[model samples]
Target: DQQVKQNSPSLSVQEGRISILNCDYTNSMFDYFLWYKKYPAEGPTFLISISSIKDKNEDGRFTVFLNKSAKHLSLHIVPSQPGDSAVYFCAASPNNNDMRFGAGTRLTVKP
Candidate 1:
Protein backbone atom coordinates (compact mmCIF):
# COMPACT_ATOMS: atom_id res chain seq x y z
CA ASP A 1 0.00 0.00 0.00
CA GLN A 2 1.17 3.49 -0.84
CA GLN A 3 0.25 5.32 2.31
CA VAL A 4 1.78 8.63 3.27
CA LYS A 5 0.71 10.09 6.58
CA GLN A 6 0.65 13.56 8.08
CA ASN A 7 -0.51 12.85 11.59
CA SER A 8 -1.20 16.47 12.50
CA PRO A 9 -3.92 17.98 10.41
CA SER A 10 -2.98 21.51 11.43
CA LEU A 11 -0.30 23.69 12.93
CA SER A 12 -0.03 27.32 13.99
CA VAL A 13 2.98 29.55 14.39
CA GLN A 14 3.59 33.24 14.88
CA GLU A 15 5.23 35.37 12.28
CA GLY A 16 9.03 35.25 12.13
CA ARG A 17 9.15 31.95 13.97
CA ILE A 18 10.09 28.51 12.79
CA SER A 19 7.32 26.20 11.61
CA ILE A 20 7.95 22.53 11.35
CA LEU A 21 5.85 20.01 9.38
CA ASN A 22 6.00 16.27 9.91
CA CYS A 23 5.16 13.26 7.73
CA ASP A 24 5.52 9.53 7.78
CA TYR A 25 5.42 6.74 5.22
CA THR A 26 4.68 3.04 5.29
CA ASN A 27 5.82 2.09 1.82
CA SER A 28 9.43 1.17 1.55
CA MET A 29 9.29 1.24 -2.23
CA PHE A 30 8.82 4.97 -2.30
CA ASP A 31 11.99 6.51 -3.57
CA TYR A 32 11.15 10.09 -4.43
CA PHE A 33 9.94 12.53 -1.80
CA LEU A 34 8.25 15.88 -2.35
CA TRP A 35 6.54 18.69 -0.45
CA TYR A 36 3.75 20.81 -1.85
CA LYS A 37 2.09 23.98 -0.56
CA LYS A 38 -1.50 24.77 -1.37
CA TYR A 39 -3.93 27.58 -0.80
CA PRO A 40 -7.66 26.98 -0.54
CA ALA A 41 -9.42 25.72 -3.68
CA GLU A 42 -6.12 25.58 -5.55
CA GLY A 43 -3.79 22.88 -6.76
CA PRO A 44 -0.62 22.23 -4.84
CA THR A 45 2.62 23.92 -5.81
CA PHE A 46 5.83 22.03 -5.63
CA LEU A 47 8.05 23.34 -2.87
CA ILE A 48 11.04 21.08 -2.40
CA SER A 49 12.02 17.46 -2.92
CA ILE A 50 14.74 14.95 -2.26
CA SER A 51 15.50 11.54 -3.67
CA SER A 52 15.69 8.51 -1.44
CA ILE A 53 19.46 8.60 -1.65
CA LYS A 54 19.58 12.05 -0.09
CA ASP A 55 18.95 12.94 3.53
CA LYS A 56 18.26 16.64 3.30
CA ASN A 57 17.16 19.31 0.87
CA GLU A 58 16.72 23.03 1.37
CA ASP A 59 15.45 26.00 -0.53
CA GLY A 60 15.70 29.48 0.91
CA ARG A 61 13.09 29.70 3.69
CA PHE A 62 12.19 26.01 3.44
CA THR A 63 14.06 22.88 4.30
CA VAL A 64 13.22 19.15 4.14
CA PHE A 65 14.96 16.37 5.95
CA LEU A 66 14.40 12.66 5.49
CA ASN A 67 15.27 9.78 7.77
CA LYS A 68 14.99 6.55 5.86
CA SER A 69 15.54 4.37 8.86
CA ALA A 70 12.43 5.68 10.56
CA LYS A 71 10.34 6.20 7.41
CA HIS A 72 9.92 9.80 8.47
CA LEU A 73 10.39 13.24 6.99
CA SER A 74 9.95 16.83 8.05
CA LEU A 75 9.66 20.24 6.51
CA HIS A 76 10.89 23.37 8.20
CA ILE A 77 10.10 26.95 7.39
CA VAL A 78 11.97 29.81 9.00
CA PRO A 79 10.79 33.35 9.61
CA SER A 80 7.25 32.35 8.74
CA GLN A 81 4.99 35.08 7.51
CA PRO A 82 1.24 35.43 7.25
CA GLY A 83 1.50 34.78 3.53
CA ASP A 84 2.94 31.41 4.38
CA SER A 85 -0.35 30.29 5.85
CA ALA A 86 -1.55 27.41 3.74
CA VAL A 87 -1.85 23.64 3.59
CA TYR A 88 1.28 21.64 3.08
CA PHE A 89 1.26 18.13 1.66
CA CYS A 90 3.93 15.52 1.72
CA ALA A 91 4.10 13.18 -1.25
CA ALA A 92 6.12 10.27 -2.43
CA SER A 93 6.48 8.30 -5.63
CA PRO A 94 8.46 5.47 -6.96
CA ASN A 95 8.78 7.53 -10.10
CA ASN A 96 8.06 11.08 -11.22
CA ASN A 97 4.63 10.33 -12.60
CA ASP A 98 2.98 8.22 -9.90
CA MET A 99 2.50 9.66 -6.42
CA ARG A 100 0.70 9.44 -3.11
CA PHE A 101 -0.08 12.26 -0.65
CA GLY A 102 -0.60 12.87 3.02
CA ALA A 103 -3.92 14.38 4.13
CA GLY A 104 -2.06 17.67 4.68
CA THR A 105 -0.82 20.00 7.35
CA ARG A 106 -2.54 23.36 7.53
CA LEU A 107 -0.05 25.96 8.69
CA THR A 108 -1.41 29.22 10.02
CA VAL A 109 1.17 31.91 10.27
CA LYS A 110 -0.36 34.47 12.56
CA PRO A 111 0.61 38.08 12.77
Candidate 2:
Protein backbone atom coordinates (compact mmCIF):
# COMPACT_ATOMS: atom_id res chain seq x y z
CA ASP A 1 0.00 0.00 0.00
CA GLN A 2 1.20 3.50 -0.76
CA GLN A 3 1.29 5.34 2.50
CA VAL A 4 1.75 8.59 0.64
CA LYS A 5 0.40 9.52 -2.77
CA GLN A 6 0.82 12.34 -5.28
CA ASN A 7 -2.10 11.97 -7.70
CA SER A 8 -0.53 13.98 -10.52
CA PRO A 9 2.69 12.74 -12.00
CA SER A 10 3.38 16.09 -13.66
CA LEU A 11 2.19 19.66 -13.75
CA SER A 12 2.92 22.55 -16.08
CA VAL A 13 2.55 26.20 -15.23
CA GLN A 14 3.52 29.47 -16.82
CA GLU A 15 6.30 31.45 -15.30
CA GLY A 16 5.13 34.20 -12.96
CA ARG A 17 2.01 32.14 -12.32
CA ILE A 18 1.26 29.96 -9.32
CA SER A 19 2.03 26.26 -9.08
CA ILE A 20 0.22 23.97 -6.72
CA LEU A 21 1.07 20.38 -5.80
CA ASN A 22 -1.02 18.10 -3.66
CA CYS A 23 -0.30 15.06 -1.49
CA ASP A 24 -2.30 12.68 0.64
CA TYR A 25 -1.33 10.21 3.32
CA THR A 26 -3.18 7.32 4.94
CA ASN A 27 -0.89 6.88 7.90
CA SER A 28 -2.30 8.68 10.86
CA MET A 29 0.85 8.31 12.90
CA PHE A 30 2.79 10.67 10.67
CA ASP A 31 3.73 13.70 12.67
CA TYR A 32 6.25 15.40 10.44
CA PHE A 33 5.87 16.38 6.81
CA LEU A 34 8.53 17.60 4.38
CA TRP A 35 8.77 18.69 0.75
CA TYR A 36 11.85 18.20 -1.41
CA LYS A 37 12.76 19.44 -4.85
CA LYS A 38 14.93 17.44 -7.20
CA TYR A 39 16.70 18.52 -10.38
CA PRO A 40 17.73 16.08 -13.08
CA ALA A 41 19.92 13.34 -11.66
CA GLU A 42 20.69 15.21 -8.49
CA GLY A 43 19.28 14.28 -5.10
CA PRO A 44 16.30 15.98 -3.63
CA THR A 45 16.88 19.10 -1.53
CA PHE A 46 14.72 20.21 1.31
CA LEU A 47 12.21 22.88 0.34
CA ILE A 48 9.86 23.28 3.27
CA SER A 49 8.51 21.30 6.20
CA ILE A 50 5.63 21.42 8.62
CA SER A 51 5.01 19.54 11.79
CA SER A 52 1.68 18.04 12.75
CA ILE A 53 1.55 20.61 15.49
CA LYS A 54 1.18 23.41 12.99
CA ASP A 55 -1.21 24.08 10.11
CA LYS A 56 1.02 25.97 7.72
CA ASN A 57 4.61 26.95 7.04
CA GLU A 58 5.90 29.39 4.45
CA ASP A 59 9.28 30.36 3.16
CA GLY A 60 9.49 33.14 0.65
CA ARG A 61 7.81 31.87 -2.55
CA PHE A 62 7.17 28.39 -1.15
CA THR A 63 4.40 27.49 1.21
CA VAL A 64 3.24 24.15 2.69
CA PHE A 65 -0.13 23.70 4.21
CA LEU A 66 -1.08 20.69 6.28
CA ASN A 67 -4.52 19.56 7.36
CA LYS A 68 -4.16 16.88 9.98
CA SER A 69 -7.84 16.08 10.05
CA ALA A 70 -7.90 15.29 6.35
CA LYS A 71 -4.46 13.70 6.18
CA HIS A 72 -3.71 16.04 3.30
CA LEU A 73 -0.97 18.53 2.48
CA SER A 74 -0.09 20.78 -0.41
CA LEU A 75 2.74 22.94 -1.67
CA HIS A 76 2.20 26.29 -3.27
CA ILE A 77 4.75 28.24 -5.25
CA VAL A 78 4.00 31.83 -6.13
CA PRO A 79 5.41 33.54 -9.21
CA SER A 80 6.64 30.26 -10.53
CA GLN A 81 9.89 30.53 -12.42
CA PRO A 82 11.73 28.42 -14.94
CA GLY A 83 14.10 27.43 -12.16
CA ASP A 84 11.19 25.86 -10.35
CA SER A 85 10.86 23.16 -12.96
CA ALA A 86 11.85 19.95 -11.26
CA VAL A 87 10.54 16.89 -9.46
CA TYR A 88 8.88 17.59 -6.15
CA PHE A 89 8.52 14.87 -3.55
CA CYS A 90 6.35 14.78 -0.50
CA ALA A 91 7.59 12.86 2.53
CA ALA A 92 6.28 11.98 5.92
CA SER A 93 8.02 10.69 9.01
CA PRO A 94 6.34 9.17 11.98
CA ASN A 95 9.56 8.08 13.51
CA ASN A 96 12.80 9.99 13.26
CA ASN A 97 14.68 7.69 10.89
CA ASP A 98 12.31 6.28 8.29
CA MET A 99 10.64 8.75 5.97
CA ARG A 100 8.13 7.59 3.34
CA PHE A 101 8.19 9.47 0.05
CA GLY A 102 5.79 9.77 -2.82
CA ALA A 103 6.85 8.84 -6.37
CA GLY A 104 7.11 12.59 -7.10
CA THR A 105 5.43 15.30 -9.10
CA ARG A 106 7.27 16.90 -11.97
CA LEU A 107 6.63 20.61 -12.38
CA THR A 108 7.44 22.30 -15.66
CA VAL A 109 7.41 26.06 -15.57
CA LYS A 110 7.23 27.56 -19.02
CA PRO A 111 8.72 30.91 -19.74
TM-scores, one per candidate: 0.96, 0.98
Q: Per-residue alpha-carbon lDDT of model 1 for 80-104, expressed as tens digits? A: 9999999999999977779999999
- Model 2, 42-74: lDDT tens digits are 999999999999999999999999999999999
Q: After superposition, how far is residue 72 of candidate 2 from its true place, in Å?
A: 0.4
Alpha carbon lDDT of each predicted model = 0.95, 0.97
For all candidates, what are the clash counts? 0, 0
RMSD of every prediction: 1.0, 0.6
Those runs of model 2 whose alpha carbons end farther than 4 Å from true positions after fitting are none
What is the lDDT, from 0 to 100, of the residue 21 in candidate 2? 99
Pairs of residues clashing in candidate 1: none
User: How well does candidate 1 score on lDDT at residue 55?
Assistant: 97
Any residue pairs clashing in model 2, and if so which? none
